[model samples]
Target chain A: MKNIIIASTSTIHGSGYLDYILEELNTFFKEAETILFIPYARPGGISHDEYTNIVKTAFTKINKTVKGIHEFENPVEAIANAEAIFTGGGNTFVLTDMLHRNHLIEAIQNVVKNGTPYLGTSAGSNICGLTIRTTNDMPIVYPPSFNALALVPFNINPHYLDPDTNSKHMGETRETRIKEFHGFNPQPVVGLREGSWLRVSGDSIVLKGHLTARIFEKGKSPCEVEPETELNTLK
Target chain B: MKNIIIASTSTIHGSGYLDYILEELNTFFKEAETILFIPYARPGGISHDEYTNIVKTAFTKINKTVKGIHEFENPVEAIANAEAIFTGGGNTFVLTDMLHRNHLIEAIQNVVKNGTPYLGTSAGSNICGLTIRTTNDMPIVYPPSFNALALVPFNINPHYLDPDTNSKHMGETRETRIKEFHGFNPQPVVGLREGSWLRVSGDSIVLKGHLTARIFEKGKSPCEVEPETELNTLK
Candidate 1:
C-alpha cells in the first residue's frame, strides 16, 4: 500500500510556505509524531539546514516535529527509520542527483511502498512519477538517468501554466513540451496546476484540490478533470 | 577568427520565421552561398525535413541555399565541408542529445572556432555557452552530459522573461532559478531577452539590440548591461 501527497507547489499565491496545505498535511501525517524532511532540492540555493528549518516551522504550526535528513549520519538509514517523509520543492535535477548519489532512492521508495506517508511538492513530486521527463526546472546538474520512483503510473508536470495568449515570448509552451516528451516517451502525464494535488491511498488516487488538473495522453488531446476526480480514469 | 550570431530566439513577436534576424544573417554569411542547417532540436515536435524546409524558406529570401545535416550521407563530413552552419531553436535537451549521440559536438565547435560562421538561436545559442545549465526548455530527454560548446565564457538563458509581479504562480522565478544554478556551479550567466543577441567576432563579443541583457554573477547582484555593450568586460 502507498500513501502520498504530491502537490504542484509548496506555496500558493499570497500564502506562506506550506500554509495553504498545512491542514491537509496535519491529517495525512496524523499518525507520525516526527516527520523527516528531505531538503535536497534547496529552493533558491538555500542550504539544507536552512531549508529544513523552513519546513520545521510549517510542521510546528501543525503540532508535529520535523527533522532534516541531513541531520542523520546515514541518509538511507534516516529514510528507513523515518515515521514519515517530506521532500520540499527546488531544482529537480539537483534533487534527483542527490537522491541517486546518496543511494537513497530505493531506500525511500521501499519505505513508501510499505505505506510510510510521503509528501512531495514541485520538484519532489516530479520524482514520484515514472520519470523526470516533464520537469520544467533548469538542468543545473546531470543525474545518472531520468529514471525515478514508480510510485505513480505516469509522470507529472508540476506548476503547470497555460500559454499566455498576450505574451510575446517565442519559447515552446508547457503543452508543447509535454507533447515533445510523449514524442520520445510512452508515459502519459498530468499537468498539475498551482493549488492542485493528488492523494494516493493504496490503489486509489484522487485529485484533491480546488483547481482542475490537465491530463495529457500519448495520442489524445489534453483533457481536464475536476477536483476530487478519481485518477484511475487516467490509467 | 570566429564569426557567430547567438540569438535569443529565431523569431521575434509578430515576425515571420527568422524575419527579425535575416538582414544580420545575410551580412554574417556574406561569403557563403550555401549553409548547413542542424535541425536536430525539432521545435514543436516537427520533423527534420519540415524544419529544414522552414529554414530553406528563410534562406531563400536572402538568396542563399540551406541544407539540413540529416539530408547528408555523413553528418561529420557535411560539417567539415559546410560553408557555414545554422542551428535553430527547440528543446535544448534533445538538441544536446543529438549533438552528442551523432558525435557532432566537437565537429561543429571546430568549424565555429576556425571562423566557418555560425548562427544559433534559442536552443542553438545555448550550446555556445559554458554549459546548458540555464536553458528554459523542459528536460524532454537526457543527454550524455550538460557540457556544451564553451564557445563563450558564460551560460545563456534564452528568451528570458522578467518575473511578472502580478502573476500568482509559485514556481521559482527565472532569476531565482539562475541564482540557484550559480549556487552549485560558479559560471556566470546572461539572461538574453527575446530580440536581443550577441554579435561575436574574433576576440570581441558585443551585445546588440534595443533592450538590455541581464548579467548574473556568482557572488554579485545581477545587473543589466547596455545594448551594444562588450561581453568581454564580464569575462
Candidate 2:
C-alpha cells in the first residue's frame, strides 16, 4: 500500500507538527524499517537546526532510522530506493528549486505513480498541483523554468494567515487579490489556510484543517466552508 | 498604420471615448460607417441614455456622424464587420463570461491579430493574457472557464493598489499574494496599478504609468521599478 503526507513543516520540527508526524509515521511505516527525509526546500540562510534536530529526536523516540537528505549527494537514488518517504516544507521556492535541479520532481512523481508511500509538508505539499500559479510567496528568485511536480490542479499557498495588527505595510488584500484572480479565471480556486492539509489515499481525498477555507470561482460569489468539505465536488 | 487605444469606457451612444467618437464621425460620410462596441464585458449595466449621450456628445463635439452597436444582435458579425471596435471595462468576470458565451474571444483575438485597432480599459485590460489568473476582483461569479484572450503571457491583475493607510488588515498583502504566484510559476508577472498601462505599438511595449510597478519571477526576489526602467525585456 502507498501512503503520502505533505505538509508546510514538521511543526517547526517537533513543535507545531507533532500530530502530523505521529500520524504519518504510524500510517506509513508500521512495517517499514526506515523513513527517507528530504529537507532541501528550506532557504540556505534560514534557521532549521531546531527543526532538523526535532526530526532526529522524533525518530530516536520512535526507534526508527531517519536519513537526512543533505548527507546524500544523490538524493534521487536515496528517495527512489526508500520504502517510504517524508517531505517537510520550509520555503516552497527554495524547495522546488532543489527538486528541479536534482531532476527529482519527476522521480518523485514516478514514485507516487508507482504506489510508493509519500509524506509532504508546506513546500512539499505544494509540488502536487497542476500548476503553482496560485502560491502566495514572493518570487524572490528564479529557477530553470516554471515547472513543478503536477500533483494537484491549483497552486498551494502555505503559511496562509489573515493579516495581523502589529504590522505597517501597504499592499492589496488577499481577498482582493483572489477576486482579481477570478476576473481572469473561469476556474475554481481553493484557498487552504494554515493547520490544514489534504490527505489522499488512492482515489480518496480528506481535508484536515482547523478553520474554514474560502473558495473562489468565475462568475459566482465566494463561498466558505469548514474542514469536512469535499473540494473535488466543486468541479 | 495600426494604432490601438485601450480605454476604460465608451459611450454606448455618445461624450465618452473622445477618439472613438471622432473616428466614427469621419467614417459616417466616408467609406467607414460602422463601429464595433463590446458591451457584454460591462454587464454591471450601463445607462442607455448616458451611453447614447456620451457617443452623441463625442460626435457633436467633433462634428462627426456615428452609429451605436445596439442595432446588431449577432456579436460575431458585428465585430467581424467593424471598421473599429472599443471594449469598455466594468466587471472583468462578467465581460469574460459574455465574450465566452458569444464565442467572441477567439474572434477578438483574430481581430487584434489582423491589426485592427483595439481599445480597452480596466476590465477590458484583463483579457490580454495567457490566463485571467491575475485580475483584481472577486470570483463571486462563474464564467465558462478560466480562459482569457491570451494576448500576453501572464494574467493582468488590474485595478491594483498599495494600501494607502498605515494600518494593517487581516488579509494577505498583494505583494505576498503575488509572491505566491511566483512559488508556482517561473513566468514573469507585472502588477499594473490603476492609471497604469502597458501600451504595445508595433513591436515596442511601453509602460505609461508614472508610478513604480512591481515585477515578480519565480525563484527570485521581487523588485519595484519606475515605468521607464528595463522592465519590458520580459518575453
Each candidate's fnat, listed in order, reads: 0.90, 0.06
lDDT (tens digit, per residue) of candidate 2 on A1-235: 3355444344532344445457556755676677777766543333345545656667665677777776676888887887777776654556666788888888888888777877776666766664444455433334454456765545454555455544332234555555555545444666666556766666555566566767767677877777766665554
Model 1 TM-score relative to the real fold: 0.99
Best by DockQ: 1
Sort candidate 1 into its docking category. Answer: high
Give the per-residue lDDT of model 2 (tens digit) for B85-203. Answer: 65666556567867888888888878777766665666677777655555554333456665788666555666555653553222345666566555544567777765556665555
Q: Which segments of model 1 are wrong by more than 4 Å?
A: A233-235
Return the lDDT, model 2, position B52. Answer: 45
Give lDDT tens digits, candidate 1, residues B163-227: 99988888888999999999899988989999999999987989998899999999999999999
The TM-scores of chain A alone, one per candidate, are 0.98, 0.80
Chain B structural similarity (TM-score) per candidate: 0.98, 0.76
Give the interface RMSD of each candidate: 0.8, 10.4
Name the weakest run of 10 consecutive residues (lDDT summed) in model 1 chain B.
B226-235
Query: Could you say which candidate leads in lDDT?
Result: 1
Q: Model 2: how many Å of interface RMSD? A: 10.4
**What TM-score does model 2 achieve against the real structure?**
0.49
Per-prediction TM-score: 0.99, 0.49
